[model samples]
Target chain A: MKLPEPIIIDPQSVPSLRWGIIGPGRIAETFVAATQKHTSQRFIAVASRTTGRAQEFASKFNIPKTFANYQDLVADEEIDAVYISSHMSDHFEHAMLAINAGKSILVEKPITYLPEEAEQIFAAARQAKVLAMEAMWTRYLPQSTILRQLLESGDLGKPELLTASFCADNRAVERLWKPGGGGIVFDMGIYPIAIAQEILGEPSSIAATGKVRPDGMDEESYSLLNYESGARASLTISGIATLPMLASCSFENAVISLGEPFFVPSSISLKTKDFYPEQTTWVDESGIAGHEGLSYQATWFAKYLSEGKLESEVHTHAQTVANIRTAFEITKQIGAKPF
Target chain B: MKLPEPIIIDPQSVPSLRWGIIGPGRIAETFVAATQKHTSQRFIAVASRTTGRAQEFASKFNIPKTFANYQDLVADEEIDAVYISSHMSDHFEHAMLAINAGKSILVEKPITYLPEEAEQIFAAARQAKVLAMEAMWTRYLPQSTILRQLLESGDLGKPELLTASFCADNRAVERLWKPGGGGIVFDMGIYPIAIAQEILGEPSSIAATGKVRPDGMDEESYSLLNYESGARASLTISGIATLPMLASCSFENAVISLGEPFFVPSSISLKTKDFYPEQTTWVDESGIAGHEGLSYQATWFAKYLSEGKLESEVHTHAQTVANIRTAFEITKQIGAKPF
Candidate 1:
């Protein structure tokens, strides 16, 4: 059994969303660059703690407006949605502010460091009748949908185990070791952990073991997730060790080896028992490449907002909170410094 | 930096030992079959609980003598060494018998399933002035030597993580669920755990989580071995799920991916930082294939005996004990039935 051709939705088919960038940081630049390059979405305003930084970002992105702080960006009536890419610790406050302002949101991966904070943000969004999503852009990629379809099709049999790791030499980065929301688990480990949750759902039990940096933040961590169905996922992420970003889902009769850096628009290979030695590689063919693939989520968000949906179906508000909640549990288990 | 060429020692160059078989079981058949087909070592006698079983084994292996009991075989003056392949529960008694009779021994793995038992067995062998070894045949395979050499070369840099799993669908086998030394962890998990200890040495901490059969043996297990150097090994084994037998060592700058069924003579791929996109695969040209590769350990044992060595230098007796101790810890943690 082969995966059906992925549903190729065109970015231009969705209604355009006027976006405002909050805390115009590094990831905000990539988000705006990708969305503007490949989608019908446009960033109308940029905001930063420093007026000069906001003006510089607006000048570079050719935005018509600049805000000295995130509060003003969420207040702009011309903005249909806000993209929150602030420092990790500020995600909850920024997201709550945007939700209460009645602006739709695409907060960066984590959504926030704690599940309770994520829950509050989503609740606020619901009360305001606004759209909210975690920018786990990988979930919206074409490859991810095909993977879900393949899994749901029962071609791979019962998914028994998933092993994934995402690590990099990021120990020198200051933001990764700050007082709050600073650590590899929040910044990097979340990718593998989120993907594991996406495939395996909630784990009945989890065991986490890891190392901490001199500053007491998590440096490297490994987690074992056990489910009632006997399915397990071994997830590892590191800041001090440069590990190959590999993700593989092993089912009863087949295996899906997602290529390195799986949380991106990359290729995937399937090896099924029926085919034995024969493996089929599925290419993304989405044409949008690299971080530009971030456009898919913006396009998806626009479609949901146009349909008056309060939350994304692909990555539900509940799933996002659960994912962060699991991360918090792992962080606590490893005795990682928390915000 | 590249790995040095693996030091190859010819099987035929080693002196042959006159060996006796104890218990005459399934793996014993493979051992004799592989050794006789590839090396100069000779099986002089066969032993089993029944005279008929011993006779049948002797006839198949062209042995001149057959004994109904292991004690008689160990006492035979013509037999210089004993190969113990009895049930896991009988290993300590069988090994002690051979050691007291002044015969060298090569016992099947787990070397008694507990660190204390292994320690006693080795101490007796040392006092008797005879060679004693656990048939961890994978350690003697050419591919294993190459992996060790690669790690030692610093080509891959400091080894930071190791991941391996060996799972099979053999739960229905009665011995696997029986009272004495029965369980997936003892019978199968030892392979991955042994190799993990091989790569990471003894871990400072180990965390295990999994399910148990209604019969009380471990149905599945996952272990995280944490080293003080911050290196870690994630090992998994199951009796219910048939997982790909994979072993990989991740270094700071590169990775060594030992091909599937890593506990065999197989290929290995090297991926380095400098040659990020270029992965080079080295195939096993040792010509020893399948169960026939078991011949390598027989040859190695004969060489050590001829050199008047009481133990193997490659895998020290202390390391073997530590490996079993870790397995015992994992088994207890998972609440699996103990022998």
Candidate 2:
């Protein structure tokens, strides 16, 4: 496939970056739609492991280019950034290839097979002068940013414990259950881990044990991590059973508890000893998009890129790596079978 | 000390069960009042290390006897049962003495220093033909019983995640920051742990970490535990901070959320997810108890005696032992100075 001319959002003014998705998964689709909607970013191309599937997705989405090979799509100079949303294991090689090709990249959470692998990809990105980041997305969300602000203001008092669980029975998503692709500790686990790292920092000790299933992949994993300051985090992730999927950080004086779907709670409540705690609601900020609550990450990503920022302090590379490291150690502790 | 004449509810009833208070503290005053209020129980004596204090408490409470030594109180035939609410380190000795005295015993929440000690007391109870149980009153509370009923009827769907936190600063209590006691995990943590165990059974694996003060006692503890069935419980307890000390259990379908002072919540809300994906408060059961919730535990103890039940199924000795064992293991893992 040949590189088509870049579709410029503001051709006569500032140049817009072209974004090509490497997989037609749900997240990739969401990313494409968001990019297509955002003028500062362009959804110019997409690629799937299967050419026919890629073409079908391209046709459905009305994209100009689609390729069967990831390497080919990434090599297309018209595309300045590659979004890798395939499987957990595929992340390392795809990220390495994109970094080697000098294209900036964003890989999904639990960015690599192991912490070492994440470090390798990061090193490659650094050595190659190409931007790379884990697509945590949640860190950039409005609620999360607000939460960070609340955390910084010292109003909640000294944070003592942060507990988070992100559980989904995605055994339904077979690609996840397959070897080297997906599993509970990698697929849904990173969200809670990342959230913990956001609030509690890197844990000094990690003790995790859970059922690793007959198929040799973790069906569910629970980890108790201790931070150096004695701050603690309990992270739970599963593909075996469904749960409330919550995130909570307890302070010395009070607590801030986020409701269901820790990834995107419809509402989060700040509660204390005061009688009857109610959730504070946020009015949607006027924007080009309709899903304001859901769109903050992408908008932040665009804003970060346009502003020439290296990384966000709230969701830094170190914390993302720390979160991934904790997940990796927990998976090993649970004896996740080698693929 | 001479035995006081039996105070029986009925002549045909069994002889009044004599009782001795191990700690002549504020709690002893309440226990004496309760024993006076209860028919089948007698307030035999009060004991303190200081002879003056012991006599002072006895005179103030109108007890028939006072002992400067706990061993003598435990040995008294006039005392058929022993209530232990002393410093935690003394519990091991006090309970051992009471058990040896062939007395029915009510040890506080943490039955002893560890699982083995609690087990020993259980075995002693069996050999001596005397009843022994952890004084976990929250389990016997009417609201907690209702919550258990709601849980059994599948009113909240499958039990999922239990988030319970109990935190209280003990600046008001003397000698609370001792090596064997005074921190949150053992002091305020037992109720929440018991509640989780009642709802979810024994966890197969547990990971816990907490804040240890300069004295090496745990000021805060956070634990993530996983049961065999993949149910998760995230529990946090602290002693250095002032918190609502509340608890809530989230299930697959609904959440059983409780209010502050979780040893007893003012209200419990059973929230179910509506078709709109919003939580509907299905049942909000809340109100002021005529008194503190611990009174419920005491009343339940009296009722159990009246009913001739050897062990309470609600807060069974076995369940309490198992939970304390978990707490003991957690304290060990967190290296909280054996407190």
Candidate 3:
């Protein structure tokens, strides 16, 4: 059984998008870098609460315009889309600002601090008749596309279990331990949970245990998601230990192991006893390594907008809501409040 | 910090023992093979329900005597130690028989079908003034000893999370599905649980979920063991998926990863930022691989007896009981009845 190749399209063939960057932080830098290098998406403007930060990011990225605040960029007529990379607690406010301005939007992961906020943002996008998507770049990677095709083909049999972990020593990051937009679950944990939701759908039951700092932010969490089909996902996130960051899907006849930092354009290998003791490692040679894979999502967004699409095909609005809803359930089980 | 060397004693220097096998099963064969190959321990007699099976095993292992029933072998005066490798359900009966016959005993993992039964056997042995232990051979291996010393030294900081998985495709094994001595938790899950207990001690709470077959045996299971120190263990077992069988201990300063089939003599590696990006993979040069490592336990048991020790220091009776009790808790949470 051959795994299908990921859909590849030239950056020149895709219609270019005039994007305004909201909140010029570390992730926004990567998004701008990926688009500028590999895609037709153009970051025409940059916005931060301070003009100095916005101007600095604009000069660094050679963006055409800079706005002191997000509202100005969202209201700009030249901006066709707004990519929200603000702190998670500010996602709802920024997304609402962009959607009210009738610009298409791509909000970063966790969509919002809560599933309800994501629902509100998408609902307003529906009313505005504009494209809306969570920039879950992992879903748009070549390896993820190949993995989805493999799973859909049933070549590995039915997936019986999946395990994923995303742990790093981010304890020194104050925002992670603060009350708002703080915690491993919202930042690091969401990736594994999103992947599990993508493969197994919503869980029938969830069991979770975690350590919450004295300030009420989650230090680490472990969750077991049990599906109706009896498939289980064991996921963990930490601000403490340095984890391998590997993800694996086990099926009746085969197993697929995604390499370290699995939520990226990394290698995925398949092992099965069908050829007993032989494993096939599928290397993703997209020439896009690490965060550079973020470009694929930008190109996808541009192509979807050109086709007048209102939602992402790869990460649907429903899937985004489902992922956040599971996060809510996980936090609830662990007794941690949403930021 | 340097990881300490394992406390190794020459197998040839250990005192010899006259062993009698109460059940000539597959595991019993490995025990006989390990002892014969590496230690001065002698297998004097073999016992099985069938005379033909007993005689065949005796001839293969070059034993001096064969018995159709366990009663005759245990009652034999020449046999000083008896290794019980029968099904889990038969452990209590076999252990009692050996204890009553004034024989030093080593029962295979899970010691008995129930923690209460293990307590009973140990109590009887104490009254009879004979040595008794659970042959959790992983504890006797050099890798396990080194891991223990590392944890004890506090060089890796405090352990905050441990992950272990021991899964195999054993659905075709009928005894694993039958009422007595059945299910993944009792058959395979005990190993990970034991190691976790050894490292972190007993947990304050446990949460578990799994799939049960039509016959009520567990097909797969996942558990979260939460300790008082806020440490957690994520464990999994399966009669379904083929898991990596790797075990990891994550601490504040470093991480220790045990190679696949961690319950065997295998390589262990240490990862820490102290060396920055360099990871030291400590390979086991014990010259024991796979089930051949079972010999280490035989030599350990002989040495303990020669020193007139009544219990294993590495795996005390209390620890054995604690391991079984955790298994009971896991089975209860998964709603599987123990055999």
TM-score of chain A of each: 0.96, 0.87, 0.96
DockQ of each: 0.22, 0.12, 0.36
lDDT, model 1, position B29: 91
Q: For model 1, which pairs clash?
A: none
lDDT of 3: 0.84
Best by lDDT: 3
Listed per prediction, chain B TM-scores read 0.96, 0.85, 0.96
Q: Model 1: per-residue lDDT, tens digit, B191-293?
A: 8988888888999998888788666778788888888877888887877665457787777777777876788888777876331345778788767776677
lDDT tens digits, residue span B1-339, model 3: 666787777878987889999878888898788779877889999889965998999999999899988999999999989999888788899999999999999998878767898899999988887889998999988888888898888888877888888777777777788877657898788899988998889999998887776656788888889899877888888878775677887888888878667888887778873312347777787777788888888888888888888888899889998988988888888888757
Per-residue lDDT for A1-339 in model 2, tens only? Answer: 111121112322334667787768776776666655653466678888874878877877688898888888889989877778876778888888888888888787768767788888887877887777788876755456557767776777777667677655465677777778767787778888888877777888998877786778887776778878756676766674444566877676566766456565244556663433333544223352322233344455555566665554567677777877887788899998624
Across residues A156-200, which tens digit of lDDT does each residue of candidate 3 receive? Answer: 777788888887777677667776664788878889998898788
Each candidate structure's TM-score, on Cα atoms with residue i matched to residue i, is 0.87, 0.73, 0.91
> What value of lDDT does candidate 1 attain over all alpha carbons?
0.83
Q: How far is candidate 2 from the true structure (C-alpha RMSD, Å)?
A: 9.1
Q: What lDDT score is found at residue B325 in candidate 1?
A: 90
Q: Best to worst by DockQ, what's the order?
A: 3, 1, 2
